[model samples]
Target: QREFTQKKTFTSWINSILAKHTPPYVVSDLYTDIQQGHLLLDLLEVLSGQHLPREKGFNTFQCRSNIENALTFLKSRSLKLINIHVADIIEGKPSIVLGLIWTIIFHFHIEELARTLACTYNQPSLDCSSAVDSSPKASRSAKKSARIKERWKMSATKALLLWAKEQCSLHGSVNVTDFKSSWRSGLAFLAIIQTLRPGLVDLEKAKARSNKENLKEAFRIAELELNIPRLLEPEDVDIVNPDEKSIMTYVAQFLQYSKNLPESEEDLQEKVREAMGWLAAQEKKLAKLLVETENETYYQKCKEMMSFMETFNQEKTPFLPVLSSKRGEAELSEGQQQMREEWDKVVSQINEWKAKLDQMLPSPLDSIEAWLQEVERLQAEDLPDLQDPFKAMSVFREIIVIFKGLMDCFDSHLDTLQSFKNEDEKNMPLVLPEKLEEMKRRLFSNIRSTNPSTFLEYHYGLCSAIANEVKLKLNICDVKYGAKESVESLLENW
Candidate 1:
């Protein structure tokens, strides 16, 4: 599902939760609960920190591949969270950033379309062609060809990197720079985006040549892969700003975050650019450290960490996780049906649970007790079904834990706390005349059996049951959370 996880945020938390579970359409319902602003924030995290296991072990350079293949059969459907968020943004539907970037992409494609049409015809139309032409300049037969040309020009690869750089630049800091999934994919992406390498035109060819077993793969091969003819290479090309400064030196330095080589002047510039993009603008004064190279230095330590990440991605040794199955499929069949049978059993259990839900709790009071019993029964009926069933149990058990707290003890003395409370509950003290007590005892004797303690426990549990209901009412599960380190000054008071 997700190769990397930063559970502190809502989307990542959802992704993290989903990563540990199975089956589709489970948490998809919670989508409405997540706020629009928070989704954008999590999407930003993916643009920044989502990682992969491209690196094999301890090493200097590390790589992690982006989820270039398969959207169908992931073991966990965590990626769905990303897909939904990104798709929404692309549709010009995101409520935040005013859909500014989505609008940008839209206008961007208009420009790309004109460029492609000119490229395809080998020249501009003799007549001015409006973006949408009433009179077809090209025959209907050639529409398919025009569409392909347009498709080639719209690179997910290029868009993603420029998107990264823009986002980093927008954030004004490169303090958190885990762009793309892995260095391999990131480098390949950069090669196409900035270097104007066209080999990525055919995603299929790129995929075939970039496999783990393909030893012929290289950082620059993207230029030749799709086109089948080597037309460009960053190694041979020189990048420079309008000011006549070589840009390769800058890119080389940026790449050196995971390298130990001496910093090139251009390299230092790139480093500064990326650092400035990712780090907060407030830290601009400290930006010079990116050029430092000596050991025991802060910049050196930063470089080593990048190196470790890069090395990890490149090491896909035998011990590291391998994908022997075909790419793009979430699950690779091992030619074994045993695992399949177990998975089916769990699905059946969940299905049966849905079917018997009403029967399981015939009475409202019974629902609370029945829920706890049902989960235990479900677990006992098939142990494997509950094995890492994070989706079903987390919120479920949180209710159980709250219920247990309500039952263990009641802070009856609380002007604010009580085992039981209602908005309509009066603050007046309990008062009853002896005549009323005698009548109440007589009424209780006639009623035969209702234990207040047990009733109170049941009532408390019932209130706890509605906790999920409250979370639902408030649209809470989608709230984003982050780790915080209390300042030493703040902790001094503690």
Candidate 2:
């Protein structure tokens, strides 16, 4: 009893000292609501102390020989920030700006930090990212995020198969049995690539660092703001056993779409839209049944990750283009214009790839300039914190989400094909399972058990199919880009 009391008192003393010295941003608005400065600072100090260099340069951060002496002094029992002090030696920057620079170390690549810490200090076995969610409607947006557990329902994706590939193979030859796993697996593959992109881990870290209350409140606001009816997050409860026959029914229904492969971008998008509606309905029905059978634990912490994503997309706009712009136009030499133009060339190359997939193209060059302008504007504004790293990671994830998903790209081709599958049914070949008659009987039984009306909600379970289509579209686009390119040689030869 005495020991416990001593520990609590000591912890309080540390908290008070930290709150007195640290900035508010260090303590996320997402987690804390009480506004007790000392407790907040204590949290910041613990979090920051975890960031201290453990052993060598390569272990913790973007290390350097120059920072060695500084690191040694900083990480000593004294626990001072000698690193930030060293960086503050700049000729004309504000003191806050120097502090902001240090924050970037964690934000830009927090995943790397997590990995290192896990390896070095032997961090907890608990997983950081909740799970993967590859739901069809997930491609666009759903109040801000679809949980990872929700995504796990998707099948494994080995490779992306697009309309182009589909045309050369089974456009008219696949049967119901073959298409079930094919479509689900395909969608899973697409979701994984997009989900695993560099920004995702960073975004997860940002969300974790956030105050639960702030994040939950933000979610509540988002629901109110976005207007989702009955917005309480679900928690895990009872698990439902998916009847095998119902699985067969799902597979059989999927094969119907495989009979037709879309040719036009519009056609593909229509199919994607179908998938979106179907998946939403399907999940809704499942959720209702779960509410009846399972406990509330399933989605308790399920804050809208997508909301954080949406918020980040808004924040990261500036820093991306900062390197090339800050030199005033009048002060610009010929070199700066060349750099901007070169960046535009890169953007255009990417657009050309998008056009082939019939996907909407991003503003290529204009967005770059806009991004640059955003960075400069933010640099001019009054920053909220000198040491917060969450903002940086938030910005990183937002950029990836917009560029990889929201930006005009090849996803439309699949959307087009998905929209008009019924029309192409005549042209598409059906791949029936070996035991067609038996499969049909079993499938119907499962369908009955699953409540066929539920599948009806997935609006036909087409979004997952569309998500698959988009993945295939992107694969082909990437292949084309990787095949060739040498401007200087071509120009000289010409």
RMSD of each: 32.6, 28.4
Q: Give the TM-scores of the predictions, in the order they appear.
A: 0.15, 0.19
Worst 10-residue lDDT window for candidate 1 reads 318-327
lDDT of 2 by residue, 225-318 (tens): 3322211221100013322222222222112222222335454345334433433443454345434534422122122222322442333222
Error of 1 at 168 (Å): 17
Q: What is the lDDT of residue 321 in candidate 2?
A: 23
Give candidate 2 regions above 4 Å deviation. 1-17, 20-216, 219-412, 418-494
For each candidate, what is the lDDT? 0.28, 0.28
Residue 292 of model 1 has an lDDT of 43
